[model samples]
Target: MGVGDVSKRILLGRKLRSAQLGETLLPKRIALPVFASDALSSVAYAPDEVFIMLSLAGASYYVWSWKIAIAVAIVMAAVIASYRQTVHAYPSGGGDYEVAQVNLGKTAGTTVASALLVDYILTVAVSISSAAQYAASAVGWLQGHEALFASAMVLLLTASNLRGIRESGSFFAWPTYAFMFAILGMCLFGFFQLVAGTLPDVESADLVISPAPEYEGAVTTLGLLFLLARAFSSGCAALTGVEAISNGVPAFKRPKSRNAATTLLLLGMIAITMMVSIIVLAKKMGLRYVDPREFDRMTYFDGAPLPEDYDQHAVIAQIARAVFLDFSPGFYFVVTVTGIILVLAANTAFNGFPVLGSILAKDGYAPRALGSRGDRLAYSNGILFLAGMAIVLIIAFDAEVTKLIQLYIVGVFISFNLSQLGMIKHWTRELTTERDPDRRGKIYRSRVINAVGLSFTSVVLVVVLITKFLAGAWITILAMLFFFAVMRAIKGHYDKVQLELAADEDDKVLPTRVHAVVLVSKIHKPTLRALAFAKASRPNVLEGIYVATDPVETNRLIDAWDERNLGVPLKVLHSPYRELVRPILQYVAEIRKSNPRGVVAVYIPEYVVGRWWEQLLHNQTALRLKGRLLFSPGVMVTSVPYQLRSSEIAREREEREDFRVRPGDLRRGQVDERRDPGRRG
Candidate 1:
């Protein structure tokens, strides 16, 4: 195999046949981690953002943390209930976009798609950036280079995903479960300590929180309501990755919708429990948090300013350290798994974005390239595109989770609201025709669940836009608009081209005659081969044409042609400006104009070289002539390849490993046992 091919195989494992796609479907155990990690990982930062927003009104407002968490949990539960109906109704894995389009209208569907697309990109950026921050806190040496670390992690995730969903899901499944256990275990132990009257304060408990200047005197006033709204909106980030499960139904094993709905229920219950427990634990332990950018506001209990270089740990880090005070290993384990899961959280977006992109492409709303699977049966183009956009965002924000978080929830909420509304419409439409009492009752219940979900999400959407528009949510809105416009333009272009390409009766008829012209560089083997191939085609007329950049070479060619007693006439067009492409184009145009109803065939000889560098040494003139001849009407340009000796290298590489054995393929029924090429004859 070529070096590039070998490298790709090593990185992405192996190329699977399209028929083997069934083997890549995930069971519930693996699907949970693959699609739910993003929502679960939000526990690492969503609570922190809530505290940061509340800190604007000082430590007194920290009491609202648990309340906001409960509100978020209620919204999440409704979302899960709503999506169960969605999965059962739309098992094709179009998720919110499909639901909105089919029930609402094309406009609503495209808007939801654009919203989901933007949110998916932000999920990767925010999750990776948060992980990088945790890495810096754990290892002091990585403090200033979080952006580089985060970008590297994005690339690593891209390579894993390029291997296909099943492989990458197995790779990430452990860390996700570990993260779940770590947080839940920590919470359970903390609650045990509280009951035993031994719960201790976190490391930041004693720091005095200084309220922001504008809100310093507003704690007892109406401004507190506005501040609480901001905090609640930030806490709602836990809902970011919930829609992924609904979008990923097709990736599940048999009974795809049931398994996906089960996964969503498990995700919602686990996420809600962990998020609420952390917020309550942080409150009971008197943990104080402020924006790292506003570190000056944090002070020692004695009214002394904290050190400029003081490192502020994330909420999970502080809780881990205090909960496992004596057991250093437990603390380290929690910290380690938390960071790893944060990085793997982006894997959720990795899977969702590519599948959704393929759907969009198939619908003609995106470029056709996104619809074609690579040799591995994965949407490789979509994966690379997601990684690249995430990297740009990471670099732009300098891997600051606090800054990236502001732009996060708007898109997710937009999709959530629209999706819930779509489900309501779907059930209403179904109820109109169903006469059976049992099915009608079931539809009634599903509709009510979606109605509740729509109400919750609509409220959350309004709060998000009101509180976050100026902060960074405006950027996401603009991004959604940009994607919407681009998709519409792509669909328009595809429609136009489709109409133009529709064949008519005239397209099926053969041309009256064929006039063949062979471009000869000299009286040599390649020229002779081109002439022989042209004659074999049995054209009505045939001639040899040459572009003369030099008179001496042109005269020598004429003498050589006459010496060979060739019956075909040779014509040389002089190029006073020494331009090869222009002279050849003029000659082809004349032939096409003279016989308007006939076809003019121009054959050019090209060298096929094996090595990359050898290709640059030949075929420059032939390539230029073909480029110009293609646009001329009724003109057919053909390349007659003459293989050089080095071309044998490519042939050898192709034969050396013509058949590869992908482990487990045969046993899984993905490969035929008797036709296995790796077996001994």
Candidate 2:
């Protein structure tokens, strides 16, 4: 093992074998938080977004806050009911993409997949950015550095997820539960105060909202309807993580579908309850909020402008401050948990995206590397890719949740509408084929449920498109289109390669003969080894080839070769330009072009160095020659490694690290794995 391997082992912990994959599967207790945090955490910001959208028309529109919340809750319920059918019907964990593909068509499936992929990336960005804002608000030192803070959070999440699902789930489960309890407790206490007719006003309740510039005059009916639609669409952020459970059904333990469906139910109930409670409580307490950027929109009741430095707290912060005025710890605890849950909310996307990527890879829609599990039985490549993309977005937007939020939920609702439609198709097809009346009746019911889901989601998707397309949602659509094109291109390339690589009778035929050529730059040990290896192959003809650019050096090599009386003949290909790879490639190409039926075996000796930096000093020519020769027709390139004295350093380090690197390991059929722990290398 090298230093990198040692560091990876330390960072990701001990590796787990493929057989231990079952251990990584989560029970319902753990699955709920691991997959539901994204939706649940939306309570911290979704209501605020709704209030922000409504505040555009002034606080007069605040009366519609709870109404929009109820509307969102209804949509979420329909989605949950629809996904319950999905979990029961297509529980292989492809989620919406699988449902859409199997029931609708390839194009529809690809579109849904592209949408979900972009949404998952945005989920990480939005959640981590929101968390960074909360952290900055709590810790003054963290201000003005949320972009770097969010990026660091992304890296940490990537590392944790690379360790395997069960480990990360266990680590994140508590914080999610704490968030749930703290938020519910705060809401319940707020309600209790409301019922007692003693609810305190929020910190910003005394402030008045100035109507947006466009709405400062008499607002038409169309304009009011548009404002309400925007608020509803913004509140729909609560539904972002709902489909994650369906996509992650396979990650659940025994009775996976049932556990997943149950988890979905719990997520929907909790998220909707919390979201509605927050909105209703905010209204009851007269929480006044406007765009933080438009500070002029907020003023005192006397029509005086609020101070420039007036800190407008978040909806949750205002609610917590109002509800826990006497007990400071309660306010701090709720605030702390909200921030923590926002960070953990991104874990839902981390889990969903990798599983979806793995499925896409298996279907040839993504790179095959995504389908391969790492030493820890996790989709490490997908995790790393998601982290990198999310970091790019975080840095690009400067970790501003408000800015990133504009690009959110559009992808999710697109998938939602498609998935629900796909489910309706799925159950209808089942009704046609399913003979048992009981199952058919169940299918009819599920079809109706999916139809209801489709109707609700379709409306939400349209609202989102109309309300947000100009407000950054266009970027999300463009990203989805880009992913769709890339996935199709990938699948097309894979299909082409698959067809070309499939074995035929012609592929089994052996070469007529083998002409071995050893690449010799000097009479050194590496060159000698290459010559010996080439001779041992017992080819039809063998020769030592050299590129000669200087007459004196060529004569010296010819005289030395004659003095050594070596049996093999030396052929020098003179290059006037002193080019190494081009001359050798031309020589091999001529031989291969002449004898198309025979194989020209080019053995290039390379130095195996212990240290990574030492590699740059050696094997430059051999690397280039092998790279070119391997691509030529009727040519086979073999690497003959000459171990240097410093290579003992690698051997000793690997030995101490319980790793072994045998020369010609592949040719000797050595499997790279551990004996005791059974790790796959």
Candidate 3:
């Protein structure tokens, strides 16, 4: 094997045969964490966001935090129920894009795809950065290096996911479950302590929060309502990943829809329970939190300014500390699991985005390479693309969760509302075509569920837009628009190319004749092979053409050609400027000028080398010549490869071995057949 092949094997492991795809299917146990981590992990920071927004109006507004959580929970439940209907109806896993395309139009489908893509990218960035913040809080050495740490986490997640969804899912499942237990355990313990009248106040309970300059003194009723609305909207970040399950139903094992719906229900329940519990605990423990940017407004109980380097813990962090006080192990455990789960939340996007991207690519709205599986049966390109974009955002935003979270939920809610709207339309259209009364009643019930989902998500979407548009959500809107335009352009390019390349009755009419030219440089095996192959094609006219840069070498080639008694005629063109490419290109253009109706077939010999360095040593002229010929109308370029000794050794090794399927290959069902009989020579 060559160095390139050896290196690829080292990076990706053994190549997998296509037949083992069944092994990659994910069961509910693994799929839950794989697809639900994003939504579930939101409990770590979503409440923190609510607290931060409410802090804009001072501590008094904190009283409404749990109310905001309740509103978000209701919307989340509605969305989850709605998506359960979606998975059952559209199990092909196109998710929102497929629903919109089939029920709505292509434009609507592309719009949803654009929104979902942007949302997926932000999901990774926001989730990883949030995890990095939690890590920084736990480790003093990681304080200012959060961006670098977050980027490293993203890279690690990307590599793990490149192994394929099922493998990565299994790897991430335990930590996700651990997080679920930690948060739920903390909430239960904290609630029990409150019932026993033994819960202690948080460390920051004595701190006083002064409102922002604009909100100093008592606020007007209208102003307070708007402030509460903004805080509620920010809390809705918890709902960002709820739609991912619907988008990824096809990734589940047999009875994909049922498993996905169950997963979604579990995700909603856990997220809601955890979010509300955190909010209630934060309120009961008197946790004082604020945006670090507004630290100047906060004061200590002794009427002194707080420490200049004071680092406020998150809402969950404070709750964990208050509940686990005197038990250092439980405190560390809760914090560690929360941080780890937040990072793994990006895995949910890692699973959903590539699947949706592959569907788009297969439909010609994305690059075709995304539709092709990689060595490990993963959508490697899509996975890497998402990781790279997330890393960029993490670095650009300096891994500040508050800043990244501002750009998070808007895109997701946009997708949710549009998808629900499309689902309602989907069921309506289906009902029109059905004649059975029982089936129609079921369809009507499904529509009603979707309608409720649409109403709830639409309200949240508007609230998010109205409240957060100026608070970094506009950036996400611009990003979604940019993606929409780019996808549309890609679709347009694919359509244009398809139209131009489609074979028709006109294409069947052959050229009046074929004029073949052999590109000759030296009297060697490569030249001989090209000449033999061109002669076998049996064109009406044939000639050996050479660009003469050196007269002595040119004369030597001519003498050798004549000495061999070669029947093919030779045509030599002289170039004083030593321009090899221009001379050959000029000759081909002249031939086309003479016979506009005939095809000029250029025969170029190419060396097939085993080693990478060997490729650099040969084929410079042949490569450039073929590139120039392709730009010329009515011209064809053919490569007649002449294998080297090293190539033969490499080929022999490949022939002796059979390919085996690696991890994740079973899910994609990709097959590699033996070489065709016609290609053996």
Candidate 4:
């Protein structure tokens, strides 16, 4: 094998065959973390966002934090319940895109696709940025290097995901489960302390919170309602990954829909439990989370505003510290797992985006490369594309969760509303074809659930637009529109190409004449092989064409051509500038101009080297020539590969590698059999 191949296998592990796809189907334990980590991990930051938004209206608004959490939980439940219906009905892994496409028509489907794509990108960015914040809070050296750390985390997640989904799930499941246990345990312990009248105050509880300038003055009822809406919108970040389960239904084991629905219920219950617990514990511990930039205006108990550089711990971190005051290891464990799970939260997007992208590619709305599986049977290209976009966002926003969160939930809610509406339409359509009373009743019940979800999500979408459009959501909207336009343009291009290339009676007619030209540099074995292959085609006319840049080599070539008595006549084209490709292209263009209806075939000899670098050293001229000749009408370019002795090394290495056990072999029932070709029984 080549060095590149070996390095890839080492990094991404071995390739899996198409038959091994079933081996990658995730069980409930692993699939929960794979598809729901993002939603579940949001408890770490969703509360922080709620508190931050509430702090804008002064600490007086802190009482509404739980209310907002409750509202978000309700919306999450409705969305989850609605998606359970989706998985059972659609079960094709298209999720929102398919539902909207099958029910709401193509425009709505494209809209959902664009929104979901944008949301997936934002999920990776926001989750990694939050994880970087947690890292900086724990490790002093990482404080100023957040963007670098976040970008590195993105790369790390990308590499892990490229290995395969099931592998990534196994790698990430421990941290996700540990994070859940740590937070839940901390909440339980914190409540125990509260009941015992021994609960300790948070580190920031000593500081007083002063409202922003607008809220510091008189706060009217309308102003209060607006603040609550903003908080509710921000808290909705918890629901970002809920739809991922529906999108990934196909990745589950047998009875895929039931498994996906069960996972969805578990994801919703766990996320809601952790989120509500964090909010409650934050309230009980007197924890305050605000954008640190606002610290400059906030006052302390001594009636002085905090300095700009005063470090602010996250809501979960403050609660952890307060809850585990006597146990430092517990504090570290909670903090560590929170940070790890926050990073793995991006894995949800890593799993969801590529599957949706593959669907879009199948529908011709995305590039066809996204539809291809890598060596590990994973969507490696889509994973890398997501990572690149996320890294760009992390660097652009400097890895600040507050800045990224403003752009997070808009797309998700947009998809949620459209998907719920599509489900309503889907149920309505199904009722038309249904005759059984029990099935009709079930459809009616599902329709009611979807209608409720649509109503709630529609309100959230409006709130998100109103509260966040000026903050940063406008950029997300523009991005969605850009993606929509790009997809439409790509679809148009594919459609046009398909129409132009459609087979018909006119394409069946043969050309009137064929003029074959053999591309030669020297009369060596490669040249002789090319000439012989061109002659074997039995064209109406054949000629040996050589581009002469030096007089000495041109004369020697002519003498050798005569000595060899090559059956074809030799034609030499002289170039004064020593340019190889342009002169050859000009010659081919002239040949085509002479016979418009005739076919001109140009045969070029290419060396097939085992190593990648050896190829770079050899095919520079031939590649350039072929590239330019492709644009000329009535001309066909063909390469005759001449294998070198080094190729045998690669071939033998491949044979040996092919017989070896690969990843997922056991799960796929791949039994290894070694048969000796040298032995005859």
Number of clashing residue pairs in every model? Answer: 0, 0, 6, 0
Arranged by lDDT, best first: 1, 2, 4, 3
lDDT digits (tens) for residues 566-676 of candidate 2? 799999999999888998888888888888999999988899998888999998877777777767878889999999988987887766555553455456344355333
How far out, in Å, is residue 81 in model 4? 0.8
Query: Candidate 4 clashing pairs?
Result: none
Please report the candidate that would top TM-score against the real structure: 4
Q: Tell me which of candidates 3 and 4 scores higher on lDDT.
A: 4
Per-residue lDDT of 135-247 in model 4, one digit per residue for the tens? 89778999989999999999999999999999999999999999989999999998899899999999988877778888878899999999999999999998999999999
Q: Model 3: clashing residue pairs?
A: 16-661, 17-661, 18-670, 20-666, 21-666, 21-667
TM-score of each: 0.96, 0.94, 0.96, 0.97
Descending-TM-score candidate ranking = 4, 1, 3, 2
Candidate 4 Cα lDDT to native: 0.90
lDDT of 1: 0.92
Candidate 4 segments whose C-alpha is farther than 4 A from its true place:
307-309, 659-681
Better structure of 1 and 3 per TM-score: 1
Q: State the lDDT of candidate 3 residue by residue for 1-681, as single tens digits.
A: 567777877766665546556667899999899988999988888888888888888988898988898898898889888999999999998888888888779888888999999999999999999889888878999999999999999999988888778789988999999988999999999999999999999988999998898788899998898888888888888888887888788778989999998988888888899999989999999988888788887898777998888888887778888899989788888899899998999999998899889999999889988888887888888998899999999999999887887788888887787788899888888887999999999999999999999899888888889888898999999999998999999999999999999998998888988999998888899999899999999999999999899989999999999999779999999999999899888888998999998999999888998777888999998888888788899999999999999898878877654344446545544223333334422
Per-residue lDDT of candidate 1, residues 1-681 (tens digit)? 767888999999877877789989999999999999999999999999999999998998998899999999999999999999999999999999999999889899899999999999999999999999999987899989999999999999999999999999999999999999999999999999999999989999999999999787756656887898999999999999999998899999999999999999999999999999999999999999999999999999999999978988889889989999999999999999999999999999999999999999999998889988887788999999999999999999999998999999899888888888889889998998999999999999999999999999999999999999999999999999999999999999999999999999989889889999998888888888899999999999999998888989999998999999878989888999998888888888888788789999998988889987787888887877777777888999888888878898788767556544467756766455435656633
lDDT of 2: 0.91
